[model samples]
Target: MPARTSRMTLGRLLGLSRENNRARDWFFEDSGNLLPHHRHHELNPSIPPLEVTKIALRLRHLIEECVPCELEESLITQAHSRVITREVVLAAKEAGGEEYRSCVVFALLVCSRWFKRQAHLELWDATLHNVRSTACEVIAKAIIEGEEDMSYLLHTVLLHRFSILVNGKPTPPANAVEKAVDLHALRVICSSGYQKCLQYLWRGWLVQDEDDPTVFVDYRGRDDQRYIVHLDPDRLRAPVYQNIARLLFSFIYLALYTMSINSVNPNGEFDAAEILLFLFTLGFICDEFTKFWKAGYHILSFWSAFNGVLYAVLTVSFVCRMIGLSYPIGHELRHSYDSLSYNFLAFAAPMFWIRLLLYLDSFRFFGAMLVVLKVMMKESIIFFALLAVMVVGFLQAFIGLDLAEDLKTDEIWFIIQAMANSVMQSPEFDGFEKFAPPFGILLYYVFTFIVMVILLNILIALYGSAYSDIYENADDEYMALFAQKTMEFVRAPDENVYIAPFNLVEIGVIVLFSWWLPKRQYEFVNDVVMAILYSPLLLIAAYFESRKAGEIRRNRSRGEDDDDTVEEWEQIEDQIDFEAEGWTKRCAAVKANVETDPAVIEVRKLMDEVAELKLMIAELKKGMDGANGKKKDDVKKGSEGDGEDS
Candidate 1:
């Protein structure tokens, strides 16, 4: 008792410096001396290690056991498996926190294994979904209640890679990098399109901790909690509302650009519309530049690459327009530059429309489809790589043949056109023989076969594979995309967000004083300016947040659980079947009243009584049969004794 030791709590461990990797390990490990005693006590007691092993082995056996021709055996196996899973899930629910997380991780691992081994077990799909749903609820509730930080869930629970203790050393599982709780959870959350989980994710993005800027930190002093928008009410700066406001602004900008480009006045000075378009484009350029500065190499993503191309064209067009204005009206040079400007601007129209898809990707249909498209595009790289090599080889052959035959250099363009046409399914085979001789025509035919038959088919196969992979796991892919988009917005936090053309004002006005001002003063100035500039959008945000607040209040007053989000999601899911007499509605109605219905209740009781009566009758019949057999055996033995006596 010479020195008293303070106990390590979960909160204290979490508060430890994130750079100390051992702290994270200690927090997550299940073994002795690793976990804090108090935290472990808070968790529901788990089944003994031996029992858990036995249960796991049983589950594995059930998953692997195949009874293809026997339907009854298969059904029995499935029912038994389901009962075991439900029991485990129930235990997990009772034991929350790490216990619940461990159960979910095990379930997902098992599901993956089962999917690989026996995907024909359709009954498992619902059981797996239930496990995921429970996991989602745990994280969602924790985040919604502000009881735990998102960083803890993401890094420690979900994204945390588990290792086996092999000979007193940590050994990583196979494909440990990709197969993690986070990936499974993300896929589940994304597939379900659950709003509560999404809210937790995006909200966590805004959280900033003093110890580690990358992770969210919960402060002991509530007032000192750090968030990007901590100085303001969340109602006024919600990410959802902010993104919606930005989308609306983008549509307006697009409309302005369309009008300006279409109504270009050659040989005349820029009009009001053109001037506004320039400002908006400038604002977008600034936004992209900032993102580039912050995201660096990460800005090389598909969407960002598209943005880069669009901005580059717009910049060139704007420069051309400016140069045209420098020249006198009706001048040849002026008209030439003006023509180039309009043409370039018009060329970007396809990109502008395609970029709109990025905003709409939050919708499940679009989001999932975008994931498919991205994957397909990635797969096309292999086709393009092969095509490039083939094209170069064929091009050289044609050029060499032309040179040998002393054909006009102008004929080279025709050969190029023919090769392209063949690839496009419009083979121009008419003039290939004229280039050199039989060799030229023969080569052309070979090239066509390679391009149209072999290469194209290979490309198609690749595309199909990529498409199937994404579509089969559409929910998870979409969730990953959604998570990516959410991060894109929050990854580079601007001390003050200035959306588009409005950003131009911030740069021209607010930034002028930023260099000379103190850090706090600069931040304060930016916040105040943004609050004023975004007041209208803030009002909209306030309305939505207030309504949500009111709902929570009403729920609490009525002593009802705050499960409004779940209820809303369920309702929305039901609404997907627009027909009044839809299967979902029918199922819900029947389920709700099944237990309460008098007729069904009576019938269930009668069935139970009939089953008991059947058991009694079978026992009585068995007893009477045994008595009759014994009497026959005794009579036979007595007759044998009488014969012996005679």
Candidate 2:
């Protein structure tokens, strides 16, 4: 996880095997009401005085207690209210209806009355500090690897809210519930140990885990929790083929769930396929519970982070299907939760298909293109980020001016329409220019000159330069990508790696015959048989591992020590480069300084020998080429003579 990996400590492995002091797994226990039942409207004003302190304190405690995910589709409270947060708005978009967002909207309405006062601001700041403190408490208690998950708390806060407040001391909006909700979400996530938990799981899953590099595992009790920390580095990694088979089975289940015809079957009827998928999902959920047993330490990567998201989505859907579809739950609850994961899978399913591209990148031609694309994307990120910031600034300025009173006020939709209209020469802009004076015409010109001309050209130039650089060394790019993937496939563990589906033979062997032998021998024999069944993979892994080791040995022999050192190949390239200093005079001055120094005389003698050897190599290559040309000519002449004879 992260680019830097963590290994498991021996103490943690002992804990996993010892099986003592097993802790209770933390889970999502619902808070019944999200918002107040009664409103503080002034006609009767029946509600008590708004006690911000009590509300903040209570909310913090609830967040700390609960998991930061939607176990049930809707909140317990039933109330109608205006939209207050971006999350609810996005959900509405996905659902194609506003009814799905009622709970969150209503909760924000309850906080709306006191959202902008000095007392509330102070309370809000105190709550954030409390959130971080709560997170820090868990972090301090656990052994950490990668960047601390709680470190993201300050970052997400700064990224979303900090910029707006820092720039100009503008009047804070009355409906600042957006920022409030984000903070609340962050608090819940951090306090729930979600981030750390995900990190730990990812470190175990994606990066060969703590015990073995090639195996993916599921545990009955989690080892990342603060109270139950067990960082096992030597947990037996199951075979890669077994994991592949498992993933394929998951796909089969997904296909059955989505594509099976319902008309032929009766409504709410149970089927064998459905039962199997339910069993698998239930097992996945149970496996997730173990991570919570020790759930407050992490080291994560992008893939693992997304895997956590998929886990949440799948659980939401699975629970909803079990309760609403299978049992007697209400229609809305079932439908919403069912849709929750379906909507996410709509986006995520394609991602799996696209990842096959990475495998394709091992091919020479495709690898060059992928490597080039990777280069371009990395270079373009900062440029695009800058453009995004400028767009946000201008768009906010235009909104503050209230230029388009007739059009929609939604910031997201406005940005989309404006980008499209700007590119199309603003077909609807003429009359709107009169809505807000000076700023309106100014917006049109700035859009034309900057967004249309300057930024677009700069982006083009960046792509052109990146393409040239990559294409110039296309072969090297291909080899590097190929080599990187080879290392990933090579350095796998020697034990317990099975060829699944067929490895049923190994499991059957264990069950029928294993009772006679010692437990250790039984395990060893089963593992050996499984490995023998998948001998091809073992041979491949061994071959690459040996090659990689030999390469390292050769590199080390050239004095590329573990300390500050460059590769031998890179050192030779650097010595050959005459234009790194730009002008001929700079190169000359450097050479002269080196030549005159007594300390460099011995090195200069070695340099001369290298040059002489390079020249000799060139002469040999030229002679070989001349001989090859003569052979080609002779072959051509012989073919012509044969034709004449015929």
Candidate 3:
């Protein structure tokens, strides 16, 4: 039978069987071969048997009349061969094994074919599961092979599925089927693959050989269409790089964790030492490539560099410990000396680099170079105070004025000797442990407190103030732009002359007030003073600006007689009265107009009504006092009876 004819017959049989048990039995057992003959006969006999034979005969007659096909001798055999069967499906499921991964591949092929043949099939759940499982396997292999293209596609698909799932809260269950797939398991299986893919993609661009342009082209253009249409390279690359950085940052955290544990028991293995080293190396490379420094350099770079140094030191110490345990020197004394030298390097390397990086990035360095000349010119007193503190500290340290009393102990002696060896061998940290005298100690403390702490705070405050002023001015500028555009469109006079400047001034005042005052005082000051100062200014400005614009519009609409002009004037006065009435009514109707928050509106209405009642009571008290005074005067004049009569 033709495929279409067979599908139509199947649909009709299912539809007709919905109302009749005998027809359903005939279709499921004899016509479709969904059940074996022995089981069917046994089940049928046990149950109150349906007249399935008669129903099958009727279905056969219908098919023969309506469907253009040769009548088959055995419908079960024809159905079994033509459509998906229980045995074929069971075999397919069984074929899916760890060693072969046959089930995943077969499922993908079957699902694709099913979708193509029956486009409206309600098989999204099954299809999604098959796709997810297949994708997991493919991603795992791709990760092992360092294939970025596959990894990118997998990540994109995951993100898309996540978005769909999140957006499907109120949607139908079928819409969220893709989101319900086991994403966590997939991610775990594909993590190594993603890492490898990221590594390849990051390094691929750097390996462009000037002698071979084709390699560069191939590297970039392998799936250009897919990248352009499906993925945002910047968005994808940024997160991946950040992930790499975070992984590197974890090394420092791991070291800290190890250190904390070691503080309790120093002999345990530092399991994170190698991991720290690996992460630091990866982070450094990513940081260099990403140019994150261009955006904001201070805290981020400093922290990254500091952590990198700390991890590097820990890694070196671990290496030294491993070597010390594994290998022995020629003599006992020599071995001890060598061990001390390695230990000294481990500590000194990190300290030296960390201090050097800080010194290089110091504000004093910038100040001396005259890089911030404008700041120096404007804030000379603050700058000089900071510089003097730094200079005093430097001189004291250089002169060795803060020497500490020597602690005479075997450990101290050993440490000193180890440092001497390190200095001799490494040519680094020549005078690292030398203690400065008392004056130097005082100077250092003063400099740290005065130059670093105080000066830094002042600079922060200055920058904050400047940022506020700029932001407020920017808002005013945007308002000006809006006003200019509105005027241009309406062909009106510069009515903004009155209103725009006042609005700008009001915004400026608010910004300045916020800057000077603490947050707690804002409501008090803004409530009492802001309305008094700004309300009248805004109202006056708006009145003049509106009048100016109106006059310009009226002039443009000239060339009418006195009667028409008088009519226009009357209309204008009517509009003015109407607006005045509207404003009064609107003040009364505000509680009804605002629907955003019912609770807030109710509270505001209560407050307003209370204020109105208080004002009305005050006015009534004043009128009663005036009337009482007049009655008292009449009584004093002996006209109390006449006044009462009147």
All candidates: TM-score:
0.62, 0.36, 0.22
Clashes of each: 1, 8, 7
lDDT of 3 by residue, 176-248 (tens): 1122121222222234433332333332211122232111111221112221111111111122222333333
Query: lDDT order of candidates, best first?
Result: 1, 2, 3
Candidate 1: tens digits of C-alpha lDDT, residues 435-547: 67899999999999999999999989999999888888897777667766665554444445567778787886565877898765565556566666776776555444445
TM-score of 2: 0.36
Pitting candidate 1 against candidate 3, the one with the higher lDDT is 1
Model 2 agreement with the true structure over 310-419: per-residue lDDT tens digits: 55655564565555465344456655654553554354455444434544564578788888888888778866886788677777866766636546554446545765
List ranges where model 2 is wrong by over 4 Å.
Answer: 1-323, 326-341, 403-435, 489-495, 498-646
List the candidate 1 regions with Cα displacement exceeding 4 Å: 1-195, 201-237, 407-409, 464-476, 490-492, 559-646
Pairs clashing in candidate 1?
A: 158-182
Give me the runs in candidate 3 sitting further than 4 Å from their true place.
Answer: 1-304, 315-319, 322-326, 329-390, 393-646
Candidate 3: lDDT over CA atoms?
0.35
RMSD of 3: 39.3
Best by TM-score: 1
TM-score of 1: 0.62
